[model samples]
Target: MANIGIVIPAAGQGKRMGAGYNKQFLMLMEKPILAHTVRLFEESDFVSEIVIVGAEGDISVIKELVYYQEFHKVAAVCIGGVLRQDSVRAGVRALSPTIQRIVVHDGARPLLTLQAFHKFLEESREYSAAIMGVPIKDTVKRVDIAGKVLDTLPRDYLRAVQTPQIFDREILEEAHQQAASAGYYGTDDASLLEWMGHPVQMVEGMQENIKVTTPEDLLLAERILTQRR
Candidate 1:
């Protein structure tokens, strides 16, 4: 079995959330949002260690939460960098040499399931890089600033990507290195791998695995959690 390590980036300012504080630290069903995300990996038997990357001044708060919650698999809670890619790089650097596979997930996505995680790992084993994504159900259109539809995209080729993107540790590290050297900033982990001429496969992701980015999203997540109970 591959030694899987999980890296969660929780350093984003989340300005779109409109919250004064970081969205990951916001309350979700009486627990911090990021805590729920971390607990999922902590309970997974396949996960060896979890590295949580937070903002510079936010480390103390995350440490408090980890101690209070007694999150067992959290091996390190390190400070993150300015960009999301940089933060992920910081977490990857913190991983032990024994970790053969790495899964990078969003700390804001508290609803990620074990099944999706397992699927990502299984796909990554066959393909060097794999990410969780759902095929777009609605017709996608490319719109201009003037609200003019430039082109109607076939939904078949469109996929809404999600987190828990798993990859072979070496492949990901090399891709990150290449991205850094080229000064290329990718929107997601798979983009970095793709730019390095690596094939990125996609695993089916659940709709419930949503990243809570706005106040409305938090309400929906709360409703989903309530319905699950």
Candidate 2:
């Protein structure tokens, strides 16, 4: 088994979800969204430890969930910083020294499967970094600030990125440190490496790996769960 460490960033305010709380705490079927996400790693053969990063006030709640849910893979509950990248940095800092590889996943994306996890881990062995994403199917347009369509982007070359981005521990740490020193925050972990001139591979991601960002997304997740059952 690989000495892989997973960092789940769940500290978002989730104002768009209109849940008045962290979306990770929102129920998907009978389980919280965070629980569902964590369960995937718990059931994964490649994951060795998990560090959940959340708001300070919610740290206890996450710890309680880990205990009651019997998620033995959970090694720590970290208090997140203001930004998503900052929270990810905190989680990275909390990883055990034995961790050779790091995977950063979104807590709201609970549709990830064990197969995806395995695939990402396997790719990590060959590449310094790899991320899961699907090719963009919609016609993409480059619009200006005034909302005028500038040009049609080549959809064939575009990808809609998702989480469980895998990275070697050294590369991830260097990326994070460089980002902090440069005061630069990328859209995701892979972007950080990209900014550092690192090459990252994109693996095929499941279409169902949707992120629960809005109420409609939550409903869709519920329907997906129902259909799976």
Q: For residues 23-123, write the lDDT of model 1, one tens digit per residue.
A: 99999999999998999998888999999999998999999999999998899999998899999999999999999789999999999877767766666
Q: How close is every model to the real structure, measured as TM-score?
A: 0.96, 0.98
Q: Which regions of candidate 1 are displaced past 4 Å? A: none
Q: Would you list the C-alpha lDDT of every candidate in the order shown?
A: 0.91, 0.92
Candidate 2 — which residues are off by over 4 angstroms?
none
Q: Against the correct fold, how does model 2 do in TM-score?
A: 0.98
lDDT of 2 at 150: 98
For candidate 2, lDDT tens digit of each residue in 54-162?
Answer: 9999999999999988999999999999999999999999999999789999999999878877876775678889999999988999999999999999988899999
Clashing pairs in 2: none
